[model samples]
Target: MAAMKKKSVKKKSVNKKTASKSPCKQKLSVSISHDHKLGHDPLAWLSGEEIQSLSKINDTVDPMTFKETKIENEKIHVPGIEAEKNIDQPVALEEMTKDIDDVKASETGSLPGDEDKTQRTNEDDDMLILPEIFGIAQAEDMHGELSSLLAVSGDIEIDASTIETLDASALQLLIAFIKECKSSGRNVIWKKSSAKIDSAASLLNIGTLLEL
Candidate 1:
């Protein structure tokens, strides 16, 4: 009976020790829920006023146009020029258009007052200038004038500035005279012409042929 009692006591002690060890070796767990307070809000790093100020600041971007991209007084290099630079934008459209028109007029020989200046009589240049009214009314006088001009050893110059009209006969006579001058190796300059000459030549469709 004593030995059975001692065995029972030993078993009870072992059971108590096992119960203590089970409580000590229990697993630890952490849980979070919507009701849980995190002490401070995560957005507390930015103040309420700071967040509002940032939202008020406009961060939206705007699109750009071609004219806006070009800087004022910017220059562009042109080819085949003497390192000349042209402005990127035209200062005045009227001025630019006027300059372009002037260039075109010069190329087409149509600039205002250019004909008078170009065909002006050079009295000091020793060129043989014809009489002003080379009219068919005095066709014999014109013939005599031509004979005298051909008698000279130099080139001939015709001053047609005072002529107001040109008849068919006069036109034919002028053509024959020019042809004869060319055949004789004489340089004939039809200098100092008026608008009347050009008008008459154009009416006959012989402006280019007569070099009016």
Candidate 2:
């Protein structure tokens, strides 16, 4: 009987220790009713605010059309050039013809009042210029003009080239000549490679660049 009492005392002590640990451990109270079905509150699940929609659903999102940006004309400026204009922009055919006429007259050292049909006036970016104004000349004549411009402009002179053929003296002279040609409002360009020539040209002083 005494042993039984001691065993009962030990069990009570263990129960007390377990009761003390009840607050630290998770204790759940389940009210098992006659119904064995699961209880669920659909409203409590998420009122559409608590749950975040799953991203990367691979569902096609509506395509978005961005507004087209307006292309602004960029004016290129060269040192010693008074006209600031966008030279790359399209020019009027009639104006270009007139420019050619004027250029012919200037080359002949004709008086400004004495107009020559052999040259025409070319207008680019609101700037007026003259190119040789002959009406649809032969291929040889056109090639001649191109060659003349190349020779006069000294395009063969490459300042930045690694080859010995191109040097600073010749490039400077070419730059000076091209600068004069552009100042005359003549839209002559290097014939070999437009890109290569333009890259070297940008190094020259034309004038203040005007962007329309």
Candidate 3:
């Protein structure tokens, strides 16, 4: 009977120790109620004055509207779009030629009265004034004038006082002109003579031939 009582006590103590070693889980009661709100206000922390200030900002600040700028009769080059070419635009050819002519006239240092003087020289065929520089370049033009003078029935008066340079070709042209005048029954009269003319003619041993 004592051994049975001791076994019962040992079993009670073992059960107590096992219960103490095991984990104890408490029951969690979660109850869902329809009285609870679904969505909470995100701006619930903002006061009435702050909310009114935000409303005023929303009313005053306008939403940006992008406007397409229309350009009339102008070419807008876009990156991907091919530009239309107007190939028929007339070139200012006459104006370009006029500009080139003006440039040439300016470079040559021609005066306005030069044309009138040349016209008079051609019309009158009486007096021929030699330029300050008489070169081979001017020989052809001088030949033309001399030929014209030869055609006219008048005594030709030559002014050589302004001749600063006299080329051999020019002296030759003058000699030919004097000879032609003599042959054409036209008198060759000297309106003015210069030492330059005389020296050039003498250097060529043709002073008597030029009647200088």
Which candidate has the top score in TM-score? 3
Native RMSD of candidate 3 (Å): 49.2
By TM-score: ranked, best first: 3, 1, 2
Alpha-carbon runs more than 4 Å astray in model 3 = 1-123
**Residue-level lDDT tens digits of model 2 in 1-212:** 00011111111111335546784443322222212122232243245332112122222111122222234445655546946553564554664456554564445352222233222122211221222231233233333333334322211222222222323333344445455555655443333233333443465532222100
Evaluated against the true structure, the overall lDDT of model 1 is 0.48
Off by over 4 Å in 2: 1-164, 194-212
TM-scores of all predicted structures: 0.37, 0.18, 0.43
Candidate 2: count the clashes. Answer: 29
Q: For residues 1-212, what per-residue lDDT tens digits would candidate 1 score against the true structure? A: 01111111111112345545894543332222113223123353345332222223222111221123222344655666736775455455554455534553443342231222222122322243434555677566566445444544446677787776557767777777777767777677777877877888878897755655
lDDT for 89 in candidate 2 is 49
Error of 1 at 72 (Å): 87
What root-mean-square deviation over C-alphas does model 2 reach? Answer: 37.5
Task: Give the worst 10-residue stretch by lDDT in candidate 1.
Answer: 1-10
> Clashing residue pairs, candidate 1?
none
- Model 1 alpha-carbon drift over 4 Å, by segment: 1-134
Give the Å shift of residue 6 in candidate 2.
99
